[model samples]
Target chain A: MKRVNILLGGPKSEYPDELSKSIKGIPGPWVGADRGSLYLLEQGIIPDIAIGDFDSINKKEQRLLKDNIADFKKFPPEKDDTDSELCLLAAREKYNAQEYYVYGATGGRIDHFLVNLFLPFDPRFLDFYDKLYYKSATNTIRFCKPGRYKIYHENGMKYIAFVNLGPVTHLNIYDAKYKLKDFNAGHPVSWASNEFLNETIDFGFESGIVAIIQSKD
Target chain B: MKRVNILLGGPKSEYPDELSKSIKGIPGPWVGADRGSLYLLEQGIIPDIAIGDFDSINKKEQRLLKDNIADFKKFPPEKDDTDSELCLLAAREKYNAQEYYVYGATGGRIDHFLVNLFLPFDPRFLDFYDKLYYKSATNTIRFCKPGRYKIYHENGMKYIAFVNLGPVTHLNIYDAKYKLKDFNAGHPVSWASNEFLNETIDFGFESGIVAIIQSKD
Candidate 1:
């Protein structure tokens, strides 16, 4: 399946090289959203398609991008959907595959990040949740709905957490240092830092979407 | 009525002078959570009591804090609520605060920050939501459930966005450059930037916990 790539622009002090490298192997087109496009271009990683209203960039960058990219859609500053979000919507309709990968939507404004996390919970995004992979410099978060997943982690990562994106019941974790069986992992109390014992772990659940966050400090 | 000052340390990068000057003038005792204690200490602003399990701090910093502070609670590293959340809970039960202002909760970890934004939405916190404020360097986000708020911006900050924390509804943003009588501020369309015709702008809503992000830049 052709994978779709999206890079979001937030207050990431770091350059976009590392995140771009993660998607280097993807077998599909890449797109940048608003500030994300600027960050990538400044780092010498120009995306194929750039979306969103250029409210965050100066006039110079806007003119330069208009000349460089294959396609650029500049929306009015005041419009529906966040810039990255607009890209995701268009990707679903355009891509030949079901899977999608999103980057740079992790940090910055609390509300911004929260909404990024909440993206998979939306019905439109949920339909493709099983196929989405979001990565940051130190972490990768995925949405697994009502199924088991075999996950591996890099050594020396600081933490890993799993939270019920919906009303989850019977969340079981095994082959990890911390194990839990038939327990609730919901809004208030999430399963955090259940590390891998054998360098690989398996998890299964009966219902609801679970967001797994594995991190390094 | 006695006011209570709670410092929320989720992961904010900077704290401006205005927030410090205002909190320092809170006219009540101070409560610190996790990284918030370090921030206040760096600023030479001391807290009367500190709470939270201290999961975010390094061992050395944690030791220095244990050596210095007297009225601090150390819970198990694994807990249900966030450090800021536990601190707020303790602050409410112990101080019976008439009002509260939280700092250092806006910047870090999108999940933690998002949860903190809706902190006031918690019924436990909501009992006193009108008395709470969350301030960052650039913006101030506060909660007023299912009602209207007349937000005034300073220094020509020039952005007013309303997020639909609840279901889709008609949100009216009046007396602004891009005035909308009844617009469906879609869930994905949370952040809106608009110029002000007048210094003060008005926003009215019907339901859900709403956050007004009045930002600059």
Candidate 2:
């Protein structure tokens, strides 16, 4: 699978350690969005493509990034798409990336976080559901279409949550600490803070969009 | 209006300073949910009612909270309603509060944050759309029904965002840096990172639910 990791300019936690562990064996092209390029440089991972308005980084950092990266696309600060959106476009259109993982797309600023949250729901990105992810130090978020799904157990994360992006119907969960059967979330309600009891969790829903988050404190 | 503030056992930031400013003149009864009671005690504000399963708090904290507050309702760890949901019920059904402000309901866990985000979208809580809020140290989140609304400028918060909880049609924004006129968000997209340019913002939609957040970094 052609997995692409796109770094965004949002917030950071105990990132470097977590980043190393999260992408231990998954080797893919790294794309940076604005200040994310500087972060990649700090982590000693040179990006293949640096795309954004480049407003968040200082002049010195910008010069350093330009000197290091060859395929860099700069835009005006005032634009229709956000810096992250532009990076996603480059990842999808330019590289035709099959699988995408996004980092630094959440935390600190709720506006940016909300923008990332709604990205999966955008009509233009609908087909990328289940293929794209919003990853952070503490959480890994993925969008799901209505169908049966199985999740294998993973360490380092404790809680599993399902957030309905739209009205969800006939939802079911099994082999989890908090099990649900034929539950319908009328709106965008959350079945949050659930635990993994068995080696895997089996879940399915009839209709609507869902976001599953495997999170740790 | 009879406004009541409910604090949940979710997450917190440099809360005291921001909480003090957010509710400086908004004097009303305070309610606590589970560990939220301990947080209130730390702030030297004893709650009128403490409602929750009480599993998140230590035994010592529970004892101290019981001695500090006169009214407390404890439930089993496994229950139908979330601790925060029970607190909202007390605020709405028991106290008959006209307006509610929620704190300590977002920040740490995505599950809890998702629960808080979907509270206003619940069928039982739909009638209280404009009256309920999920407030935190950095952001103030409120839900709006389909109607024209005007928002006056507020200090501290520099950005305003609109996230569609459902498909929003005929959406409009005026007096802002990025104005939207007669546009429809086909899905639950975020109109994020907008600035207030005219000391106010006027927005409305023909249908669907909307969450407005006044936020800062």
Candidate 3:
């Protein structure tokens, strides 16, 4: 299993301990982007691949990263993709990994956070979204294609929101809080925050993609 | 200038400061959406219209809002539009305000924030996108249609990213940190955080709707 880990510029310290406890069992070759590099360093971990223009980190920290990390790829100051995204592209090359777990990815500025969430929608990564998993302090989110998914729960999140990630034409929630039958949640009204009724429930959608956000508070 | 002020939830204490600052020297009716009502109260200011399901605010706060505000309209929990959206709809009917300024909208949940940024794509507000302006602490963003625009800057930000908010055929940047000549920044490699070079700059495109984010680190 070629496992790949990508960390974006987020409030990693706030989510570090939580993620460490949860992701300890998952194996991977970690990659860092911008501030995400500094975050991993603070935790005494070195990234295998570091990609960015090096704006977020100071010169001394950049030197430390250069000396410690195995490979560092620097793009010009101007680029089409976000630094975090560039890291993902590099990640694809290195990891034949079956699963992808992203950290330091949630919270901080809303714009950056949203970009990462919608990134999976990119045609390049859309095919692999089902294998992707992301964990913030109080939420664990992932996208599921047309299939039956078994969600394993940790105690942090109280509610589970089944956002159509994109608009699903006919979405049916077999087991969840606020069940819907053949639902078409259009553009404006995305299922904002819905609760999960039971501990472990079965959910399978027939046609479209669904983003599952298991959140607390 | 038919100025309209729409207050939505953000930081509680900063709400008043932002509200007072955003509404200063503006002549128009004010509108609040969902918890936006409570946000105005946090600053000791109330809007003319209270729209949407007051679910974000507690029962006590809702009661206080109803007692103090005369035009309070509540929707069912299950509705087609998000709360902030309903306020804009109501504002169109009641105020007929052409230019809308959304206050205290950034620095929140990523999902809510993204929806707000793309609010222009909503069929209800699609035609009026040019009249919209979104402000964050370090950035003032505007979504524009294709052609060209001249931006005036009092101070320079470290970064300014212009993304094809919707898919664009061809985009050309005359002067920028990474100036481009008739480049195709299609869907996947969407323009992300990029820096600025001078105090004043010009930009134009061949086609498509674009989001101009004049931002910083």
Per-residue lDDT tens digits for candidate 2, residues B1-217, read 4888888876566243557554445478889999888877887788999998887778998899888888889899778788878888877876777889888777667777777777776777776757887776667788899999998766788888888876678888967889888776545777888889887899998998888988886
Off by over 4 Å in 1: A1-4, A14-17, A20-29, A97-99, A121-126, A146-156, A164-209, B1-3, B12-14, B17-28, B55-67, B118-123, B154-156, B166-207
Q: Which candidate's lDDT is highest?
A: 2
Docking quality tier of model 3: incorrect
User: What would the TM-score be for candidate 2 when compared with the true structure?
Assistant: 0.90
Q: Give the range of the ten consecutive residues with the poorest summed lDDT in model 1 chain A.
A: A14-23
For candidate 3, write residues A7-100 as lDDT tens digits: 8777653364545565445466689888677767776777888888887678898898888888988777657677767877778767756888
User: Per-prediction TM-score, chain A only?
Assistant: 0.85, 0.90, 0.87
Ranking by DockQ: 2, 1, 3
Worst 10 residues of 3 chain A by lDDT: A184-193
Model 2: per-residue Cα lDDT over A75-188, one tens digit each: 997788888888887788766767898888776666677778878766677767578778776678888899999986657888898777777789889768988898875457
Give me the runs in candidate 3 sitting further than 4 Å from their true place.
Answer: A12-29, A72-76, A79-81, A106-115, A121-129, A138-141, A144-191, A194-217, B11-29, B154-156, B179-189, B197-208
Could you give candidate 3's fraction of true interface contacts? 0.03
Model 1, A53-113: lDDT tens digits are 9987889999878888878889996685777678877777677466677877765554555
